[model samples]
Target: MNFCKRTDLILVLITAVVTTSILGFALSNQVVAQINGTQQQNQMDYTGFHSNIEQIIAHLEKAEYNKFFNNNTLTLGHALHPIEEVLTLVTIPLSTADSNLNDTYFKDLYQLSALASPGNSTVDEFDNKSKSSIELSNEVVATVIPATVLSTTEHNVSVIKDLLTISGSEYKEGVAGGNIILELEYQDGSAFMDRAYTLFNNTQNISNDTQSVTKLLSDFSNLTDSVQSLKEPAVIDQIIQKMNIGLSPNDNSTTSDVSSSQTSQDYIDTIRGLLNEVITAYESNDKIKAKELTTIAYLDNFEYIEASIGKELSDRGEALLREKLREQIDGNASIDEIKQNIADINKVLDDSAGFLDSNPK
Candidate 1:
């Protein structure tokens, strides 16, 4: 009996060891399979992240290029700005994944998407200015010089057109990536926005005159028409007509006083006073001041005509006239242009002779 019990106990111990080995092997295999699955998941996640980054980089490039006249001689001297092309590429190890990269990359994708405006985009302005410069140059070349010897002609022509034609070849000659004066995206860090807004606003700023000047012009236009109906000074009447009041040869100003039911004699006096000074400048042979005042007068009156009677002449009126005045005031006016303008004014004045005797307020 004692021998039988000892054998049974040894058999039980052997079975227990076998069962433990089998369970341990199964557990070890399960751990290895789990580890392999995790590695595969990490690789897929890395690939997806990389793809997202690539898409973002692509969109940023597209938006940036749209914001400029690329490789423009008048604009930045570069095939592309660094902000448009350069991106900081990141490679994350499997042991380390960066959360900041994920957040920033996604945000960039949203901003550079086509759904956003990018604000004050230079795309239209640059395209128009650059293309218009070329087209206008071609037109002037055709109009001013015949097909006969246009290549050898030496006639002075459109100021902007000449600048564009001479500089057309310069667009392709710059470094591939030059220094960027403006950034490629929206920015609130400064008064001026980045590349997009900076470039579009630059050309417009040069053309924008002050509100005070614009208002003074409106006042003068109204006063000239009022002075015409009264019979006092022939010289003043001629001056009123010569100023191009309401853009008519006859002085007929657009009245804004219909709502208020009062005509302004003060505006008349102010306009008369300014003309009095202009007359003095012309009479004293101060060509510079006369030209300056004439430039202001032309532009101001033109703005009035543009605001009032210029809807019909929208395509033809005031544009070239304003540009000419801008050139005169900004010192780009040629001596010939200035002399011609003065001669036109003098012609009108000469038509109404003996005007000094009929002058009294």
Candidate 2:
């Protein structure tokens, strides 16, 4: 249920909070009064937006908790929708002068919120708008390259080149082409390199921590075994690749393809639905129906991983035991037996982490 580092997403959110710092800038009483008919209602709306932001935060936290167990994005997106609405409803106070500059971000969020998902287009739009506002200028255009980013990111290269051309400047060493001049920050590479190194190390350490994985597994069911030993090397590599995407600077292949037909959230809902169906079949004493639900929902998902483990009594074995035990429960196995089977599976999963450690990818 781990999510890769979402630096870009977090940046979008963080900037939105203080983006309206211009609201506190010089506002005439007339402008303020014209914007809000009543001072009391204005105060109320301000207070309400604050409360709404908090409520949205609660939604994200709850969604994250669900994701920790289920790895469901649908659940997360469902929660994000409310906050998106709140961001939309927050109108900019009607200050005609400099309002376009001030309201640029609020305007952006209005569109971002309406999207079914703030997919790549919305995210890129927001990023570009936010960046251009702070850095770009029609009068003063220059090519500024960081040593680290120049080696990668073809898009950024085109962007800088376009800025140079638009400025109508010809370059000959320090001689400017029109108004465009190349201004390079020669020492900027150190800070970016340090940040990249730190991110990689921190992510690797967290993913490799046996205790943390075991603790996470413990929460699913109190199966007490060290989890580092049970870790899957391929899975670990997948995780590392996901986490290191932007941070690595040169790792173009870090991104995963969305090949699973169902969205993460949809997949989760299907599993949950099957679990409910299994419960219903068990309650009705329909052994065949219960097995059908369990096999389709859980067993099929694990079948690929089972073969990958390549061991007799590894994670796969424990999973098979749990699946069979669940079927046995439908056929009148005792509750204690069910618990025992789960515990056994937990131990096996935990030990498999060690096997993963020994066999590195």
Candidate 3:
């Protein structure tokens, strides 16, 4: 009986140990399966995230290239669409078995996107286009503006010239007849002036008295000869000096003072007065006075006057004035009619001048 009882106790102990061992093994296997399943899910998530990011990048590159090709001008505004989309994709929660892997993936995507987007080129292109547009606009202005102002100036000059010829012829037609002085002066002044003066003079000589014409011609010839002999280079030198002074990059205060002193309103007014005097001398039948005034006026204010008018007017105005002159010559408009037309045009220009002063470029 004692031996049987001991054997029974041993059997119970063995059974208990076997049961515990089996439970432990099962629990260990279950834990390992759960870990493996989680890892597989994480791998799948990573692969999807990476693939989506690549698609976003591809779209951005395409958009950027499209904009670049279309306008030949790049800008950040163009990239806004692509960048917003990329950020949305990057911010989405990505599953990763390791937290560190998720952080690294996001960080790299952000950096790469930034690198691929246009930055300096966009800024530079905007700046360049703006500057170019401004420059072209300035060119057009430079061409058109000066010509407009100079038209009035040239008309005023032509009026004075015509009056001089008429008066000079009346006083001494013998001197005025073959007088090429007016022709020379007009030719040197402007092509329009030359053509107009030649046409007018030729027409007048055809009907005028021969002796009077001869006298006027001789006097004008002598006058021109005297001018040629003077040989004074002072006027040209003054112009060069003034130009040099104006162009110097001095302080604004000094430049303002110099330009003001050099460009006195009185100088401009004096030229206008001199031009009027030339007309007065002619209408009064005083060839001597007309010739004297012409010499003095040419010496005192011609260069300054011409320079001022030239600077104020632009190339486009010059072209338009030429066109108008051609039309007038072809139509055979009288001098008085032409003068009235000029006055009307000048009124318009004066209004424009006022506008320009009020609203500076």
As a whole number from 0 to 100, the lDDT of residue 5 in candidate 2 is 29
Q: What does candidate 1's lDDT look like per residue over 1-361, in tens digits?
A: 0001112343344334323322222111111110101112223222222222222222233333444634222122111111111111121221023334423332332222212232323566444443433343233234322344333212111121112111111111111133222232111111111211222222222223466335435534443333323323333223333322222223233111121122122222232343344456545544334433443333223222222222333223333233333234234345556555544443333322223224321
What would the TM-score be for candidate 1 when compared with the true structure? 0.20
Judge candidate 3 against the unseen true structure and give its global Cα lDDT, from 0 to 1: 0.32
Candidate 2 positional error at 166, Å = 53
TM-score of each: 0.20, 0.22, 0.20
Candidate 3 lDDT tens digits, 1-361: 0001112343344334323322222111111110101121222222223222333333333334444555322222222322222222222232113324334443433333333334424534534433443343233223322444323433322232333222222122111223433322222222222222332344332224576445544534443443334312232223223322232224233212332354323443443454455456445543323333333333333333232343344222222232232233224345554445444434434444454456553
Off by over 4 Å in 2: 1-290, 314-319
Q: So what's the TM-score on candidate 3?
A: 0.20
Candidate 2, residues 200-270, lDDT tens digits: the string is 23232333457644443332222111112222323323333333332223535321222123232333344
Count clashing residue pairs in model 3.
Answer: 29
Collision pairs in model 1: 183-195
